[model samples]
Target: MKAVSELLKKHDGTLWHVTPAMTVFEAVEQLARLEVGALLVMDGDRLAGVFSERDYTRKITLLGRNSRETLVSEIMTANVITVNATTRTRECMSLMSARKIRHLPVVEGERVLGMISIRDIMDDIISDHEHTIASLESYIQS
Candidate 1:
């Protein structure tokens, strides 16, 4: 039942982003440098879309597009899915599963807060389970 804000608290609130006009090669470099799977494509403070490894593979590599020439806007997923700080972790998991997406931007009325990945939610769930198991064991020993 932890809120998205609670989860984000554990992470460095860094919203990694790239402009839509950025070349795919540059974006890929940023992705590799940041060690992240996706980057929020931003136009100033607005959320433009998302450019991910999936986009690169499907739109660039498979199509033999030149990464150095192609722009992120051309291959980025335009219709982005976002959540707010108050959204629960379970809801996020369900939404990601239903939408078949790996990354979600946390927004507050148009202001981008941070990004959350499927891996983040899974790690939180595993941690919660471990805590619950420990609590139950402690109770049983009492």
Candidate 2:
């Protein structure tokens, strides 16, 4: 099975991030503009935390925090669970499921490579199953 590294080979290893002090509202706007579900919080290119729409809804909105006043750092997931490029898709699924996180930063050494989403794994799983089923049906017909 191909790994996350293979999945990211075409992504140019570009990771979108925002400043820690950015307001939650600003982050949400960027998220909408970028059409991404999450953004990494960076401190001089160092991974600080992650901001997700879920964070805004759950930690800010539900908690009665002001989005324009609340900094993303205040609601970001500080304890980020990262995955290595070499990690398998199945492993990624397992980690995401266990932690209940949808996004994972893909790292190689001290540098961030890319981000992976649960949807990525789900698509890979579905594609693989379809291929396998097709191969089985072909064999049975022959």
Candidate 3:
């Protein structure tokens, strides 16, 4: 099975992070500008937590809280579930499904490496299916 390490190899090896003290508004703006759905909240190189669009919607918007006043750390999901680059795609998919989360931070050692989404896993599944079909067709032709 292909591992996350193989998939992460295509990414730019960049991890976008924000400080815990940043306001929810700032985090949302950064996420929008970056065209990303999540950001890692760093407490001086430590994975303090994770901020996601859902966090904004549920904790800030739905609750009628001011994004400007609300801190990202207040609503961010702490103790996040992370996977290493060497983790199998199946395992990653399983974790996402079990946790009902769409994003996962890829880590190596104590540093965040990159982020992977459900879309990335889905793309891998589609590619594998296509390859299998191609191989089957070749076998039938032979």
TM-scores of the candidates are 0.97, 0.93, 0.94
lDDT, candidate 1, 32-77, per-residue tens: 9999999999999999999999999999999999999999999999
Name the weakest run of 10 consecutive residues (lDDT summed) in model 2. 6-15
Per-residue C-alpha lDDT of model 3 across residues 17-110, encoded as one tens digit per residue: 8889999999999999999888888888788889999999999999999999999889999989999989999899999999999899888889
Instruction: For candidate 2, write residues 8-111 as lDDT tens digits.
Output: 87567677888898999999999999998999888886888899999999998799999999998889999999999899999999889998999999888778
**Model 2 shows how many backbone clashes?**
0
TM-score of predicted structure 2: 0.93
Ranking of all predicted structures according to TM-score, beginning with the best and ending with the worst? 1, 3, 2
Predicted structure with the largest TM-score when compared to the true one: 1
Off by over 4 Å in 1: none
Q: What is the lDDT of residue 103 in candidate 3?
A: 90
Q: In candidate 1, how many Å is residue 140 off?
A: 0.4
**The 10-residue segment with the lowest total lDDT in model 1:** 6-15
Better of 1 and 2 by TM-score: 1
